[model samples]
Target: MTRLAGMMAKSAVAPLDRLKILMQSNCPHYSRFNLWSCYRAVLNKEGFLSFYKGNGAAMIRVFPYAAIQYTAYELFRPLMRALMGPHSHIGNFTAGAAAGTVAVTSTYPLDIVRTRLAFQVKGEHVYYGIMNALQKMFHENGWRAYYKGYAATVAGILPYSGSSFYFFDLSKRIMLKYFPKQTTTVNEEKGGRLELSIWAKLICGCLSGVIAQTAAYPVDVIRRRMQLIGMHPAYDHYNTAMWRVGVIVYHEEGMSAFYRGLSLNYVRAIPMVGISFTAFEFFKQLLRIEEHAPTS
Candidate 1:
């Protein structure tokens, strides 16, 4: 029957659709484009492939992290605006902060895994899966390990997201101010000039990511060190004090230790932030969300 044949085709395509999503999710094209490039260069000192050490697990983590991050930003932001008034910077900041927190929380476990995987070298003990990583952490250091460096993650993401939302919003305003005609063109075709060019939005997002990342870099370093604490046998004594950990690293490996993987971090940051911001901007526009002019 025609109906039976249609159902068969749908079933055959379902797996392909899932596979496409999985590949798209796992691709490090964004990471490779940004901070990961730096990370890779650093890894080249060790070996060519060192840059991708924990990449398999990291890819898995990215799927959820990206989805949760974008979804939370989109879904929670407007609800925040509705409740707090559209033009309030306070509201925007709070919404952004909450969205960052929620997205990070949803994806923290995977982040922990990704960090663990990235830090892994050949012959290093590696986690098998998410549940295995959780079990291993709990078995070794109690439940606290799952949340290790979580404070730093929160500290970093809060400003990162807040600035991202704030600056991206501002950039569009500036773009509109400079190119009023674009708005008219956009309005004619895509509803309004407020729609913004894809390129403009990308530039705004990339700049925002840089500013936000700069502000939060130290916390990010702390977060990564904290996440890697339990993985290394020598670092077992890493206490909760961020400065203390830095001191110990300095004492052990001198100043260079603290910055061991910084190149990789930068490599991962640039493009990741660029893509993330671009994605956020595009999604926001796709949803027809208007940027409320910030009141100074």
Candidate 2:
């Protein structure tokens, strides 16, 4: 259920997701970095279907990614709650950060493939498909290539996941406080839990996603740059890729380099997160997962 929800959420914003990757990777063809201009460029060059170029790989990667993430969160949340007590904000953040780290570490290779596949432009196809791309990467750079930007990804995921869960829990608390009637109490075997309206859940999810994505946007750009170390000319230093790319982006492109595709990220993330969390919660209810405070 979590996997299906994640696929549906990502599929809805797959086009924008590709656009964000293109813009962030500093595609050579585009003179500027506006969403509409990039959209038009992709449309003119590769036609409409181009937007979904790497979506197949994305789905394959995201299914296990989402399953691991949500499952890890569920496991960690209860442990944290036991240690930190009920409704601990720190517990929520810690659980989320840990879950994200576990998920990314487990699924980082597919992410590299997904990015490489998405970065391919019309008439410049470097990879034939997912398996071919993986084979080439293995033969060329060996196993290390799969974890090119591991440090950067872990760094970014820490705050990205922490703040996302923190803000989501905070938003729910605020909503329930201000609009008590919109929430109901569910009597579980352990205790009574606050159940929010679907509207509240969606709003909280959207706002949390925007805030967390924005906060970690620069790190995300750096992670992408590092991940493309062998593929991109500017990021050729594989051994010292993370710091080297950071220095290059800072010195060569100034501060804005780290925020190249932020707008598109927000565009993709808002609805994706809104739908993801809402769907997860809906599925949880249907599956009879306990609807307690700090619901994973």
Candidate 3:
């Protein structure tokens, strides 16, 4: 009976352990609240339940989106580290940026869907599904439409995801410094995994999120403008190009407009970052994998 119980425990432990490893290594890639936060801000004026606007489709999209992103980063990290060297933070940053780009590229369509859903008003016409949106957007705008905010998105991604990798590592190093005896990993023979407290992880994650968001918020605003389905009609003569978008936003909305949703972004960022980082570190420790976490 004891042996059977032990075997069952081992089986359970294996998947749980694997999950932890997956989160830490790929958390930045998979874990996030960008679309959700955007939706929430729109809904806040209408009602409390607004955040779930496209949640059903979004939830469906998230799994694959996350899966592709995490998997890509996992595959890319080693190549990046090998080529650039593990000790180089620049290598880590580049790996994170590249990983983010790959992940975003794989799931950009879904991201567009999520954004459309978030931007939807109750009576407004919204695309029915991924294919419909793609078709309609292309028919109306051309190929460039699909990648509407690609520049700002890519720019925002670099610092946001890059910082995540940087700060998480920095925080971990800080922890290790203070707690000299703490072990990030454990030998199964001795007992089991060594997990960092949720609080500690959250603090570090929040800090990472804030730093990254601060660096990238202006670009994010421009990205939103570019992504809008009907910005031209509303804003009139606004430039579609990224540099032009920045100029237009500054011209109309002024400098403050570039920081739209700043407070809300931070509110959403703290927990989002915490979840992403915590999940990531947890997974990394569990898997005993070493890789750079993205700044996002």
Which candidate number has the best lDDT? 2
**TM-scores across all candidates?**
0.70, 0.91, 0.72
Which digits, one per residue and each the tens of the lDDT, describe model 1 over residues 4-93? 332333333332222221121222222232333533544454465454444545555555666666667667768877988876677777
C-alpha local distance difference test of each model? 0.59, 0.82, 0.59
Best by TM-score: 2
Cα lDDT of candidate 1 equals: 0.59
lDDT of 1 at 244: 75
Alpha-carbon deviation at 192 in model 2, angstroms: 9.5
Better candidate number, 2 or 3, judged by lDDT: 2
Put down candidate 2 lDDT per residue, 83-148, tens digits, no spaces: 998788899999999999999999999998998888888887879899998998998789988988
The superposed Cα distance between candidate 3 and the true structure at residue 227, in angstroms, equals 0.9
Count clashes in each candidate, considering only residues at least 3 apart in sequence or on different chains.
15, 0, 16
- For 109-163, candidate 3 gives per-residue lDDT tens digits of 6665556554544445457656777788888778766776777788888887777
Off by over 4 Å in 3: 1-49, 126-132, 181-195, 229-232, 288-296
Pairs with steric clashes in candidate 2? none
Candidate 2 error regions (>4 Å): 183-194, 237-241, 294-296
